[model samples]
Target: MTKVVLTVDDSRTMRDMLRLALAEASFEVVQAVDGVHGLEVLSQTEPDVIITDINMPNMDGFGFIEAVRRDERRRGTPILVLTTESDAAKKQRARAAGATGWIVKPFDPAKLVDAVRRVAA
Candidate 1:
């Protein structure tokens, strides 16, 4: 099966950047505007992995991961948080919320691809 990836962020440019990078690595990208919408997408799309931004309207990354972990079908899905904040506390919160890994933004295209490949596999 073709591996699918969910990219959740409020910014269209960030989603585009992720699409370009992950597509080069042979994964299909599905974009979502926020955590609430991300969950809706997950129901229909069933991505192999999820990459989400922490601060978003409607719902944030922490809420998204919590919801994902609560659902048995999505409990094991790999969730990688890509964000601008580098605060240790935020990272700890994400780790506690069940995030598989993290990538700090101003996203390095190379690191983004490598991180996705590493976690999604």
Candidate 2:
């Protein structure tokens, strides 16, 4: 079965890049503009993996991950934080908030696909 991935980011360019990469890898892609929209989309779809940006307008990735972890149904779903920030403290924080992995911005298509495959349930 084709894996489903939800990507949440504030940048249209990022979203488009992600969609192209994942789609080319044969994964179904769902997109949201920010954490708020991510949650809204999450309620409607059961994605195999979720990739989110750390900085967003409403509810950053940390908050989104925390909220997802709070839900029993989504507790086991793997969330990958993809952002420009490479701070170790922020990475630790993301892990605490329930992120499965971290990927920096300007991600390589192959690596992104690999990470999704490795984490997707």
Candidate 3:
């Protein structure tokens, strides 16, 4: 089965970038504007992986991760954090919140694809 991936970010450009990369990597893409919208999208479609931004308007990445972990259906889904923040503390918090991995912003598309492939597998 083809892997489906959810890319959640407030920025259209970021979502588009991830879409292009994942598409080339042969994964189906689903987009969401923020964490709230992402959760709604998740309810309708179960993606193999979720790539989300840390800071957003309605709900932040941390909150989203917490929610996903709490949801029985989404608990095992691999969630990768895509953010500009490189602080170790922030990474630690994200890890504690159950993020599968962290991808720093201005990411290399190839690396991103590989990471997603690895996590989704």
Best by lDDT, which number? 2
* lDDT (10s digit) by residue, model 3, range 40-84: 998899899999999999999999999999999888899999999
lDDT measured at residue 86 in model 2 versus the true structure, 0 to 100: 99
TM-score, cand. 3: 0.98
Q: Which ten residues in a row have the lowest lDDT in candidate 3?
A: 67-76
Residue range 39-107, candidate 1, lDDT tens digits: 999889989899999999999999999998999988889999999999999999999999999898898
Least accurate stretch of 10 residues (summed lDDT) in model 1?
Answer: 112-121
| Candidate 1 stretches greater than 4 Å from native | none
In lDDT terms, how accurate is model 3?
0.94
Q: What would the TM-scores of all predictions be? A: 0.96, 0.98, 0.98
Model 2 Cα lDDT, one tens digit per residue, 1-121: 9899999999999999999999999999999999999999999999999999999998999999999999999999999999999999999999999999999988999999999999984
lDDT of candidate 1 at residue 24, scale 0 to 100: 86
lDDT, residue 85, model 2: 97
Residue 81 displacement in candidate 1 (angstroms): 0.5
Clashes of 2: 0
